[model samples]
Target: MQRDFCDPLGYMGTRGGDVTATMAIVPRIQQVRDCAAAAGLTIIHTREGHRPDLSDLPENKRLKTARAGAEIGSRGPLGRLLLEPRPGEIVIDKPGTGAFYGTDLHHVLATSGIQNLVLVGVTTGVCVTSTAREASDRGLNVLVISDCCAEPDPLEHEMAIRLLQIEGGYIATIASTVDFVASVNTLAQS
Candidate 1:
């Protein structure tokens, strides 16, 4: 999962001030993180933080992206991990939507022998879906915790989930946070 918090664009409801959408998923994200900790699962956090050089991206895109990040005051508390990752939990700074892009996420996952990834974050149609596609391409089994992901548009969120379900002839599983945590608990017990 990537960029779970921050960025007010997707979090605000129809009423400009309402943040129900973002607030709704915070607990679910916490549940998944807590379950993973209880199960001894390694959790990797990814945040979009472009470099000052802006060499990773084209000039046109770089300018707009940097401005948006700055406008949101991402460098302050908003940019920090909402659920501060515990020590030893890997935190990656990604240049793009997919965690694997412009990062050593692939190498880290491979070296750590992680075959299955559980994706949970904001903007299902964007970052979450992009990461899922990338993970599928890299031969990792992907599971997205639907409830833990939020999109400004309900239909867009559903569409993203459907796309992930059958992408590139590979199937990615979708489950609610409750179900996912239950499965993790079962495995831990067994």
Candidate 2:
């Protein structure tokens, strides 16, 4: 099956938001990138859009996000993708936590004949988990890269990863970055 690595809400730098924990996942992200390349897989990177037109979001949410310093279109560094996506790699700007929401990701996956997804990124309990659920509901096999995902609270991150492992009638699988990379390498060799 054609697999894709889905990175959601990977905003880097403190100016964008709390990235201290997320920073630890950068090298793991690079490992995933290398594995994808070797396995001839695709990498789908999603960034949350913070454009000035806050009409799409509720007033409370808009206010909260603004207070958090993540105005999508703001000239701030938060609007930027933490990692530089390679040329030709798919970069999706999403309005919500679920990558499939209000985005062309579904169509892109379908057209690309992608059947499996390996999910990673920041705020594991939020965007990463949300996308995993959405992907499961869509009938795509989902594997979450545990070590490549992070949250501000280590407890929350662990709990979220645990919950995701059995979500939607056991729809998701969790793997560490090292194990995932090894598996990918093995697959390539076979």
Best-matching candidate per lDDT = 1
Report the lDDT tens digits of candidate 1 across residue range 30-123: 8899899888899998877666665676566656745555332234433355677788899888878888999999999999999999998877
Model 2 CA deviation exceeding 4 Å by range: 1-18, 50-55, 69-72, 77-79, 167-169
Judged by whole-model lDDT over C-alpha atoms, candidate 1 comes out at 0.75
Error of 1 at 107 (Å): 0.3
Candidate 2, poorest ten consecutive residues by summed lDDT: 1-10
Pairs clashing within candidate 2: 16-78, 50-72, 50-73, 51-73
Q: How many backbone clashes does candidate 2 have?
A: 4
Residue pairs whose backbone atoms clash in candidate 1: none
